[model samples]
Target chain A: MATATIAGADVTVDEEGFMTEFSEWSEDIGSALAGQIGIDLSDAHWKVLNFVREDFQAQGETPTLRRVSKVGGVPTKELFQLFPKKPAKKMSYIAGVPKPHGCV
Target chain B: MKRLLILGAGTAGTMVANKLRPRLDERDWNITIVDQDETHYYQPGFLFLPFGGYSRADLEKPKRAFMPKGVNLIMGEIDLIEPEDNQVKLVDGTTLPYDYLVIATGTSPRPDETPGLDSDEWYKSVFDFYTIDGAEALAKKLETWEGGRLAINVIEMPIKCPVAPLEFIFLAEAYFAERGMSDQVELVYVTPLPGAFTKPVAARYLGEMLQERKIGLEADYMLEQVDTENSKLISYDEREVEYDLLVTIPVNMGADFVDRSGLGDELNHVPVDKHNFLSDAHDNIFAIGDAAALPTSKAGSVAHFAVDVFTENFLDYIEGLPMRGEFDGHANCFIESGRGKGMLIDFNYDTEPLPGKYPLPGVGPFSLLMETEANHWGKVMFKWMYWNILLPGRELPLPALMSMAGKIPEKVG
Candidate 1:
């Protein structure tokens, strides 16, 4: 287990820096995680993250990339632009959800 | 009684084994195929892994499952080949002697060959889609990716699936468009070739596709090193292309054991007679697929076609008869252009891909060098054909050689 300090609070992260618990996830933590990966979150980024978080709470699993675009009302290209390098993992990381399976 | 030992039970090796099993008599002949692992990957499926359509199970199966019942399958690391002694030494201290040896150990992506390519940011920032792991990793990356400049680069040429990088860019364009963030990602195709593709006619056609898609073309760019610290590709000619995310197809080289055996070229490819695939250095050895230094694309279709010719020639060689079959270097590929549209290209060593119909003269279910939905379906259906018919050594409706029947002759300029 690895721990990252975001806004002076310790959050548990997996080996790949993915969040270990949803309870530790906050908008501020998401912002800090984004800063570490060299990105600044926008409203659009928040919208996707919120959708993923809500979807996870309701469904008990990370939302598929396709569902985020098709049902979550975000387009695929914008989702990519928001997450940059790796949208699915990065989004799951910031959203404080378990890393998506079958993603690697 | 004699033995035929094959190295690397991959695409070419598996096909050869299946095709030869029924032809060779068990009482007088024994066939053995060796590979480093039990898993046989449908490599073409790797290209689709980054996208949603294909799954991991769809691309992989047990190698022995596809191998014929009579052929012996040995899974171990290959140490060296002592062709003069008619034997191969395995890392586990197993020595297998063969009367005829076939090397089908294919090419692999060598990211380490490029400086800083395998650095700290490998799966984090820089990525490749050539391998299953790489594709899966990229799939995770693409999930919430806010795009910037997406640089799709090829380190060098003679790569397996030469058109794959182009296909990636096309699919990326469509993916971005479908996601409604089309304006966010700027697609750039960086290649060592001057145009979009290797063939002139195909290059012209594919080049237009890039242009129409608004993807930037950075042609004739020879990679020198990956500036991982800065997230940019610095070419040998001092050209630099910055990117937010780098998707590269690294330098592909034949297996290292080929180099150790002293029977390979500078790139570790075994030099073979282009027609019959007989090793230039040894009469009893033949190298097929990406291992052979054939003057054609390093593609599955080429391996399939070559196997068709080699099957006949190989039977004749062991019987002390002159080989009559000459491989014409026939190859065909379906290029996915996204939006449920794709293109087909069929050519050989002597011919370039021209605009025409395939398998028939006037009417074709598939068109060549032109994008069509039918071509995309053909591209999708090929996975079924590859596993069920092609690997089992079943006969296909297509010919092994390129035909001039439906092709339009090049007009004099």
Candidate 2:
């Protein structure tokens, strides 16, 4: 892991730039992380990101897109529209949580 | 008398019973195993069923035959697992109480969970090789298939025997060639993973094999639904892969009783301490096998290794002592690469599968991460071992924890 400046906040990140510390995140920091990955945070995007953040806080792991829709009251089709392709990875990167491990 | 109640008489449940029975004295411990059926499927055999390699006799046996002679075996569908009362309710109105509960119902393909998957085209064009019926249907389909684009899609990750889909494609590649129709068939391996597998070295090794056989790899696909009307797979991101023969591994979930018990994750898998398979919530409840949300492959190899650790730790737990075993998440798989050639992979939680001789350093009868004829025989011989040695709880020479002794570690891996 390495520390980097994102949105002018010091944060630790893994080799793939996924946030190591979930506590080092704010709405401004999330937007900066989103901007780096070419995503603009709309209310729709925040709707998904916020759910992922809160759910991860509760479940203690990154929630899959299916869980966000099924348990968090968001439709899967809309998540695709908001986070676009690769929502699982992109959402985790912006939400400042560890990316979901490809559980073998 | 103290009671030990184990649910599901599949690979894990059966193994747990056999391992614990001889150790837990009959005078003091009363062990009872419950399941919905009597037939114990040699699940690893299911992969070869599509190729007409085995019949019902070779793949199945009575669960009673393997019981350790002292344990009680109950057959009935589970209605609910009442963890609070420490009892399980069967659909037949029988309630079996236990001092300790082991949930090992395992996971199964839930095609109905996805739209249009279990519909009109099921067993007609779209198929799944995870079940006996599906494998038999696929076998018949292959017998006279006028080949076209054959797409093997994995609907989700953490599916049982994750290598089976790749093995299916490999066997299909060789099977079509033997029929003098290699050109007539187009094989595509579609998965949500970015490559042939989750691990780096194995994926590269397996990915290269796919390229050599001229099979297409469609990766990073998370399915939204199966479009039965058009005979195609529609991904969540609007990507589409049209196919003629779709062999899909639909979303695999744990038993419904787990969900009803309010003791499961989103996928209905019981949350547990990974090292010991102890329930995160209730102290008396433990879930082993695919029923537990383990971070490793849900293959029989994992169940075997995990059961070994759980058995030892369980012996201590009942005595009110701390579990001394820290399970390393050891798992191995034999990948059938067709034409009497297969590959072996061995690894644990901290390590990815690497190339080396397995079980013996520089002198393995079977090799790891490289396809060979010996590996194929190892897989074939494993069936005999599974019935005679593995499920019966007889000791195998192999260690429960993974060792790097035979492995040649490399930076690239």
lDDT of 1 by residue, B1-413 (tens): 79999999988999999999999999999999999988988888888788776878889999889989899999999999998899999999999999999999999999997898989999988999999899999999998899899999998666898889999999999999999989999999998777899887899999999999999999867677899999999875568999999999998889999999998765688989989999988999999998997778999999999999999999988889999998988999999999999999999888888999887986888899999999999999999999999999999988887898888767845
Q: What CAPRI grade goes to candidate 2? A: medium
On residues A6-100, what C-alpha lDDT tens digit does candidate 1 reach at each position? Answer: 87889998777888888888888888888888879888888998999998897577775656876699865576668764577788888889866
Candidate 2, residue B126: Cα displacement in angstroms equals 1.1
> How much is A62 displaced in model 2, in angstroms?
1.4
Interface RMSD of each: 15.1, 1.5
TM-scores of chain A across candidates: 0.91, 0.94
lDDT string for model 2 (B1-413, tens) is 99999999999999999999999999999999999888988888888888888976789899999999999999999999898899999999999999999999999999998988979999999999999889989999989899999999999887999899999999999999988999999999999999999998899999999999999999989898999999999998889999999999989999998999898888998989989999999999999999999888999999999999999999999999999998998998999999999999999989999999988999998899999999999999999999999999999999999999989998741
Model 2 per-residue lDDT tens digits across residues A1-104? 89999989999998889889989999999999999989999988888888889988987889887788888788878877777888888889999998888467
Give the worst 10-residue stretch by lDDT in candidate 1 chain B: B404-413
Q: Residue A11 in model 1: shift from native, Å?
A: 76
Clashing pairs in 2: none
Fraction of the true interface contacts (Cα pairs closer than 8 Å across chains) found in each model:
0.00, 0.71
Off by over 4 Å in 2: none
DockQ for all models: 0.01, 0.72
